[model samples]
Target: MHRSLFNILSGRNTRQGLWGLPLLVALLISLWLTVETTQFATAENLFNLVAQAMPLIIAAIGQLVVVLIGGLDLSVGSVISFTTAVLALDQPAIVLIPAVFLLAALIGLINGLAITRFNVHPIIATLSTQYIVLGITRILRPVSGGTVPEIVIAAVSGSFLGIPYPVFWGIVVIVAAWKLLYGSRYGLHLFAIGGGIASGAESAARNFGVSDRRNIILAYMVCSCFAAVAGVFLAGRIVSGDPNVGLLFELDTVTAVALGGTQLSGGIGSLHGTVIGALVMALLANGMNLANVSPFVQTAIKGGILLAVVGLQSRKKMGL
Candidate 1:
C-alpha cells in the first residue's frame, strides 16, 4: 500500500512540475497585460501579436529539431537573411522558393557534413557557415530595399477563411512537426541519435534504423528549409528584405528551445513543448512592448530569465 501510494504521489508531482513553465508564462503574460493599458487586448493588437510571432516561432521550431540531435544551427539567422534577399531579388515561381530552400538545405547539409565527417563541433561548423552565407547574401543584394509583390502582401496580411495566415502557418507546421516527432520512424531515430551516436546506432541497428549521420544532416536541412520559409514571411511583414534582418534571431531561437526543457547537452524534448515555449516568448515580447518596457531592459530581462530557467533545469536533471 505504501509503495502504491508513493508511486501515485510521485506521478502527480511530476505532472505538476511538467506544467511549471507554461503556467509561469501564462501568469507573466497576464500580469504584464493587466498592468498595461486597457487597450492591450483589442482584437487588432492580438492579431498584430500573432503576426509578429510567425517568424520567430517558425525559426525557433527549426532550431528545436537541430538541438534535439545534440547539435546547433547558428547559421539560421543568416539563412533567413539570405533567403529573404533571394525572394526580394524576385524570380519566377519555379525558380524562386525551391531554389532558395535547396540552397539553404545544401548549406545546412554542408554544416552537418562538417560536424559528422570532419568532426568539427556544431557551434564552430555552423558559425563558419553563418559567415559564408552572410557573405553570399551581401554580395547578391547589398542594398536592403526590395519590392513587395501584391500576392504575398495579400497572403500574409490577409486571413484565409477567417484565420490569420501566420497563425495558420504556425499551426500547420506545428501539426506536421507533431506527426513527424510522434508518428514516424525518423522521429524515433531523432531521440535515439541524441542518446550518443554509437550507442544509439548499435542498439537500433538491428532494425536498420535511421543513419545517425543522415539524421544529423536531415536535422540541419529541415532547419534551413524552415528558416527559408520564415524569411519569406518576415519579408512580407516588413515589406522588404532588410539586410540587417534576422539579427539576433539565433539567440531567441536557442532560448526558446532551452526554456522548452530540451537539454543543451541534447537528446530530449517534444515538439509540442518547444512550440509552447516559443509562444511564451512571443507573448513576453509582445506584452513587454505593449507595456512600454525599454528594449534594452527587455533584452536584459530575457537573458536573465534564460539563465534562471537553464540553471533550474540543470538542477532538476541532477536531482534525477
Candidate 2:
C-alpha cells in the first residue's frame, strides 16, 4: 500500500493527477450547486463568476511563479491595493497604467534584491514591503472614494463574441504562463532553483549553470506585474480605488496555489492546476453565498480548506 501510494504521488502520474484534481473538484461543486439551487447555472451568473475570478486567476498564476522559485510574496495584496490607489487618481491611462506597472516592478526588484543580495528571508522581505506599500496606499486614499476611468471599466467589463473580457484575459494569462513555465529554458532554471531550495541541492543546481539570481528576480517581477494587472481589473470592476479592496488577496492566492497542488516547499506545479484552483475557489465561494452562509463562516471554511489541502501535500511528502 505504501509503495502504491508513493507511486501515485510520484512521477508523471502525480503531475497529471494534481493538475486535473482541481477541475474535478470544481465540476463537482458546480454540479452540487446546480442541483441545490437555481441561482448558479444561468449564463449571467456564469459570466459574473468568471468576472469575479479573473483578478484572482491572474494573481494565482503570478504567485505560482514565485512559489516555483521556492519563495512567497506576502506583498501581493499590498501591491494591488497600491495600484488601485494609484490608478484611482484622475490621471490619464497612458500615464497612470504604466506608472503602476513600473512601481510594481520596482517593488518586485527590491524584493528580489532583499532576498538575493541581502540574504533576507522571503517572508520577512515581502512582509516588510507589504506594510510599506499598504501604508502608502492608505495615505494615497485614506478611504475608498476615487474615480476609476470609465474607459477602463468598459474595456475590462466588455464582452466579445459572447465572452467576457475578463474571462478572455484570464485565458490568455493561463496559456502564456503555461508556455513560459513549462516550455522555456528560463522555466527550467526556475524549477531547478525551486527543487534545489526544497531539497538542499542549491550547489548542484548552480553547478548545472542555473542563474538563480536572475530567475528569482524575474519571478518576482512577473509576480508583481501580474498583481498589478489584477489590481487594474479590480479597480475597473469596483469603479474606484479602494485601499481595502485587496486586503486578503495574498491569502486567497496562496490558498488557491496550494489547493491546485503546488508544493508549498516549491518545485512541482502547473498553471493548469492554478487555473482550475482559482475556478474551484470561485465556485466554492459562490456556493457558500448561494447557501446563505455567513461571511465569517465562509472565511473559516476557506481557511480550513487551505489547511486540509496543505496537510494532504505534507502527508504525501511523508509517504504516509
Candidate 3:
C-alpha cells in the first residue's frame, strides 16, 4: 500500500507527469488561505475565485493542447484580446460571436502554416501573429469602451441552482477538454506525435501513419478557439471590451501549464494536472490580494514560480 501510494504521488512510469505534487501544493495553498483570512472560505469569495479563474482555466486547456505536441502559442493572449474586441463590435450577436471564432481560427491557421509549412520556429511565428493581432485589436477598441452582446453578458452573470454560471462554464469546458484530449483519436495522435518529437525522432509518429502536419495545424486551431472561448467568458464578466484585459495571459497560461506538470518538451501531461496547477495560481493570487500584497510583487512572484518550476526539470527533458 505504501509503495502504491508512492508511485501515485511520484507519477512513476506514467505519462501524466508530476501532477500529484501540484495537487498537494494546491491543497496546501487552500489550507493556508483558509487559516490566514476570515473571508477566504466565505461562499461569496469562493464563488468569486471560481469566476476569476475560469478564463485562465479555459485558456490553459488550449495551451495544453499545443504543448502536448511540443509547440507553444504565444499568440493566445492576443487572440483572447482580439476575441473580445470583435465581440464588442457594433453588431448582432449572431454576426459577432461567429465572427470572433472565425477570426481566431484564421489566426491559428496562419500561425500553424508559418511554423509547419514555412519552417518557422513556433516562438517566432506565434510572436509575430501576437503582435499583428494585438495591433488589430487595439485599432478596434482603443480604450475598452464597447459593449458586448446581451446574451454573452447573460451567460456569465447569473446563478443556476445556487451555483454561479461561471462554475457551470468551467464544468462544461473541462468536460469538453477531457473528451478531446483523452477520449478522442486525435488526442492519442497528439501524444504520439509529441512523444516522438521529444525523443528526438520527429518522424517516428509519421512512420506509424499519422499526418503530423494536419494534426499540428488542427492543434493550433483548437488552441485559438479555446482562447476565444476564454475571451467570451471574460467579455461577459466585464460587460465590455478591453484591449488590455488579456495582457500577460500568455505568460500566466504557460506558467499554469508548466506548473501542472506538463513537460515543456511535450508528450507528457494531464488535464487534471493543468486544472490543479491553475487552481494553485488562482489561490496564490487570492491569498496575496487578501494580504494586501502589491500587484507588482505578485507579478514578480509568479515569474519566480515559473522560473523555479521550469528550472527543476531536467535539461535533457526540456530538450535544451
Candidate 4:
C-alpha cells in the first residue's frame, strides 16, 4: 500500500512539474472565464479568440526560432510594419505579394548576415534594422490607407465550416514547429546552438558536421518570414496598411515566448508552450474586455501576471 501510494504521488508530482504546465493554466483560465461570463465559452467567441491569437502566435513562433539560437529580433515589429505598408501600395496582387515577401526575406537575410558574418550583436543589429525599416515604411505610405485584395482578406480572415482560417493556420504552424523541434536532427542542432551544448559538451558536433553560423542564419530567416506572414494577415484583416499597425508587437511576442517557458538566455523551451502562452494572453485580453476592464488596467494586469509566472518558473528551476 505504501509503494502504491508513493507511485500515485510521484505521478501527480510529475504532471504538476510538466513543461506543458502553462497550457493547463490557460485551460483553467478559460474555464474560469466561462464560469464568469456566458459568452466566454460560446463557439463563436472561442473561434474569434483563436483567430485573433493567430498573428500573435505567428510572431511568437518567429521569436521562438531566434531565441532558440540565443538571438533576438527586435525588428520583427518593424518588419511587420514595413510589410503592411508595402502591401498597402496600389499594386497587382500577383506582383505585390511576391515582391513584399521577397523584400521581407531579404531583410531577414541581412539581419542574419549582419549577426553571423559581420559579428554584430543580435539585439543591436535587429534594432538598427528596425529603425531603418520603420523609416522606409514612413516613406512608402505615410498614410494608413491602402487596399488589400478582397479575396485575399476573405480567405485569411473568413471561416471554413464554422472554423476560422487563422485558427487552422495556427494549428498548422504549431504542428510543423513541434515536428521540426522534437522530431528531427536539425531541431536538435538548433537546441544545441541555443543551449551552448555545441560549444561545450557536444564540442565535436562542430567538427563532425554542425554549423552554428548556418543554423543562426536559418533561424533569423525563419523569424523574419514568419513575421512577414503575420504582416500579410494583418493587412488582409484590416484591408489596409498602417505603419503603426504592429507597434510593440515584439514585446507581445517576447512576452508570450517567455511566458511559454522559453528562456531568454536560450537553450530550453517548447513551441507548444509558446502557443499556450499566446492563447493565455489572448484569453486574458478577451476576458478583460468582457468584464469591461480599462485597457491601461489590462496592460498592468498582464505585466503582473507575466512577472508572477516568471517568478514561479524561476523558483521551480531553483528547486524551491
Candidate 2, position 176, lDDT: 86
- Which has the greatest TM-score? 3
> Candidate 3 on 119-216: residue-level lDDT in tens?
89899999999999999999999999787999999999999899999999999999999999999999999999998888888999999999999999
Candidate 1 residue lDDT tens string, 1-320: 77655543232333112224554676677677866668667787778878887888888888977877778889999999998788777665456767778998898889889987998988999999999989988887797977655566666878877778888878887887778777888877777776553233333532565678888889899998888888888877877666668777888888777766666555666565576667778888887787788989888877886787667653222211
Score every model by TM-score: 0.87, 0.93, 0.98, 0.86
Candidate 3 vs candidate 4, TM-score winner: 3
* Span of ten consecutive residues with least summed lDDT in model 1: 9-18
Better lDDT candidate (1, 3):
3
Q: What residue pairs clash in candidate 4, if any at all? A: none
TM-score quality measure for candidate 3 = 0.98
Best-to-worst ranking by lDDT: 3, 2, 4, 1
What would the per-residue lDDT of candidate 4 be over residues 1-320, giving only the tens digit for each residue?
A: 77655543232332112245667678889999989899998888988787788889998988988886668898999888888888878888888888877888888899999998998988899999999999999998787987876756886878888778887788777888788777988788887776664134434446657898888888888898889888988898888999988887877887788777776656656777788788888988899899999988987877787577557443222211
Candidate 4 residue 95 C-alpha distance from true site, Å:
1.3
Residue 286 of candidate 1: its Cα lDDT? 81
lDDT score for residue 202 of model 1: 30
Q: Pick out the ten consecutive residues of candidate 4 with the lowest summed lDDT.
A: 9-18
